[model samples]
Target: MTKITIPLDNPTLDDVARHADVSPATVSRFMNNPSIVSERSKRKIEESIRELSYVPHAAARTLASKKSRMIGVVVPSLDDALFGHFLELFHSHISTEGYTTVVASSGYSSDEEHIQITQMVSHGVDALLLVGLARDESVYSLLNKKKIPYAITWATDDLGEHSCVGFSNHDAAVKITEYLMDLGHRQFAMISGTLKGNDRASNRLQGVRDALARRELSLPDELVIEGPIGIEHGQKAFKLLMSRSPRPTVIVCGADPLAYGAIFESKVLGVEVPQDVSITGFDDTWLAAHLTPSLTTLRTPQQQMSLLSAEYLIAKLKGEDVDVPPTLGVDLVVRESCSSPA
Candidate 1:
C-alpha cells in the first residue's frame, strides 16, 4: 500500500498564480478589481483557489488595512427568539462584508451592559450593536472617547442623537393598542416584562397608555402586572388579572413569550381565549403564527433591522459615508387571539 502525504500550508496568491500561469499581481487585481482582469484569467484564478482550498490570511489583511474585522453585539439574553433571530440576521449580513461578530449577554442588567461594552472596547471591536438607548452614561462615554462606531437597535426614538436602525417602538405599540381599542376592549389589563431597565418595554407600555388615554382608558394600578420576560411571568400576570372582581376583557403583553404564557394560563384556568378575553402581544415571533389560535401581534421587522444595523456599522467602519441610516417599519398583525369584547 502506498501512503500519500497532503501538504497543509494552504494556498496563497502565489500558489494561485502558479496554478493559473499568471503573476501574483494579476491574482491581486482579480481580488481587488475583478473588472480589470480578463474573464478567462479571472475564471482560472478562482478555480485554482477553490481547488487548492485557499483561505486568505485575515491577520495579514487586517495588518495591511488597520481594521479589526469584528462587530460587538450586546443583548440581554439569548433565550428570547427575537434577539436570537436578530443575532442570526446581524451576523449573516456582517459576515458577507468580511466581518465577524462578538456577542455578549448583559443578563438584563444595565451595569452588566456597561461592563460588557467596556470589555468589547478593550478587545477593539470595530463597531458595537446595542439593543436600545437605555445604557448607562459610562457606556456612551466609552464609545465617544474611543470613537467606536455603534448603532442603537430594536427600539427607535424620534430624538435619537446617535444613528439608529429600528422602528419606532412607541408608534408600533400605539398602533396595536388602537387596534384592540377599536375592537371595543375597554377594561384593559397588561402583562408586561419589567420595564425598569428596558427602554423598549417602557416605550411599549407608554404606547399602550397613549392609545388608552385617547379613549379615557388607562391601565389601572391593580390591573397592571410586571414580571421578568417569560411565559411564566405572563401566567402569573394572568392569574393576577383574573383575580379582579370585574376582570379585564383584554390583556396586553409586552412580548410574544409573555402573551403565550398568558394564553397558556388562560387555558389551564379553563378560560376561553378571545371568547371570554382577548389577548395581544408585541414582536411577532415565528411561533406567534403557529399557536393554537394565531396571536395578534406587532410584526416588528426585527431581522430587517438587525441586518441593516450590521450593514450600516460595517459601512461606517470601512469609512463609507452612508447617505441614510437604515430604519425599518413595524406593523400590527391582526389575528385570532384578539377580537371584539365578549
Candidate 2:
C-alpha cells in the first residue's frame, strides 16, 4: 500500500478548480452533483481534489443542495423541563436522520420568537420546530415567503391550518379540572403561566374557565393569577391564593415547575396537601413524581411529539406525503397531591 503525503495547508474549492483547470462553478457542481458535470471535468476535479486534499465547504455544498439539514427549534424558555424533555426526545429522533437542531429560547416573548425565527431563516435552517401555533401573522408570512417548512409542537390549532403535533392545552386543562371536580373539589383557583403572547398558557386558563362553567361554577378574576414559568412565581401565586379567606379547595397549575412552587409554598404555610387543599399541575416533569406529595399532572406526549415532528419534517424534505394526526392526546397522571376536599 502506498502512503499519501499530507498537504501543509488547507486547500479550498477554488484551489481545486485551479488545479483542475476548470471554473469554480464547475468544481461546485462536481462536488454537489457529479452527474451534472461532464465526465472530463469530473475526472479532472476528482484528481485535483485527491492531489490537493481539497475539502468542500460544508455551508457552500449545503447551499448548493438548497438544504441546510438543520432544524431550528424555538421554545418559550429553555429553563423549563417540559421544553427540555420535548427537545431531548426531539434531538434523539431528528438526529437519526442526519439533521441537527439549533435551539433558542424566546423567553416567552412573541417578539423574541419572531426574532429567533427570522434569525434561523437567515442562517439557512431547512425547517423549524416551534412550541405553539399562535404567533404573529408576519411570522407566518415570512415563513411562507421563504418557503421554509415548520412544525408546531406541544399545542394544536384547529383553524390555523398549520402542521402540528401534540395535544390540546385547552382540552388537557379541562380534563385536569374535571378530574379534580370528580374528586369532589368545588372551590378552585389556578396558578397559570403568563398569558400574553402565549397560546399554551392562555388556552389552559380558558380550559379551566370552561370546565368551571360546566358545573355552574366560575373562576372570578381573583381566582386566577398569571405569572412567568418558575417555582418562585408559583410560590407567590400560591401565597396570594392562600391568603384569601377560605382558601380554594383545589389549585391547578399550568406547568410542573409552577406546581412545585405551589407545593413547597404549601408546606411552608403548614397546609396539608389534599387534606386542606388539592393541587394539580401540567407537564408531568420528573420532579413532579418526586415531590413531597407527588403532583397530579398531565403527562404530555413529548416522545410522540418528537417522533411525529421528525417524521413530518423528514417527509417534507423527501417530498413524501405524511399524515399528521389532527391532535395528539395527553394522559392525566393522578398522584398524592390531589383528593376530595374535606
Per lDDT, the best of the predicted structures is 2
lDDT of 2 at 281: 87
Report the alpha-carbon TM-score of model 1 versus the true structure. 0.87
In TM-score terms, candidate 2 sits at 0.85
Query: Which regions of candidate 1 are displaced past 4 Å?
Result: 1-6, 9-61, 323-327
What residue runs in model 2 are displaced by over 4 Å at the alpha carbon? 1-56
TM-score to native of every candidate shown: 0.87, 0.85
- lDDT by residue for model 2 over 228-263, one digit each (tens)? 889999999999999988789999999988899999
Number of colliding residue pairs in each model = 0, 0
Instruction: Evaluate candidate 1 by giving its C-alpha RMSD to the native, one decimal.
Output: 4.1
- Residue pairs clashing, model 1: none
